[model samples]
Target: MSTANERARMTDLALQEWGVVVGILAERGESWPDTDVTRWGPGVTAAMERTRALCAACSIVGATEAADIGRLADLYEARTRS
Candidate 1:
């Protein structure tokens, strides 16, 4: 569990890392195209959905935990590796 401040910080960090992932994908010719899932495939759609879920969790009180943030970081790493 994390305090509100901690969750806020973690969420910001996760989003920043996600932004880096998106940039890397863009370099590889994968553009997000602003919510147009048809522009990308299911994998990218899943990543974006995860990002949106993180944001949703952060908005609700006590919804986001330390482990959740860690999972997002791990997901980012796995995406980068593959």
Candidate 2:
């Protein structure tokens, strides 16, 4: 079994990873055209909120790994960046 300190450390790392994902998502949202923003903006915002919720709830272990989140952030940046 993991100690409380280890769990806390994992949570912190997960939140940091989520933060990177959120930032990339925000950048992706900013790149959307105004016409399509109406339809897509809410979805992006929801995704951001969900990540924050996951971090707040401290669901790190089997939920999502930091490396996975980093990969996702990288994918978002690559696909959305100009």
Q: Ten consecutive residues with minimal summed lDDT in candidate 2? A: 30-39
Task: Give me the candidate number with maximum lDDT.
Answer: 1
- Model 1 lDDT tens row, 1-82: 6587767675665666467547756766764443445666666666666666665666554534323545555555565589
Over the full model, what C-alpha lDDT does candidate 1 score relative to the true structure?
0.59
Error of 1 at 11 (Å): 0.7
Off by over 4 Å in 2: 30-82
Top TM-score: which candidate number? 1
Candidate 1 lands at a TM-score of 0.47
Clashing pairs in 1: none
- Model 1 residue 75 lDDT? 51
lDDT of 2 by residue, 2-53 (tens): 5677655765655555555466555666431232435556656665566556
Candidate 1 error regions (>4 Å): 28-36, 62-82
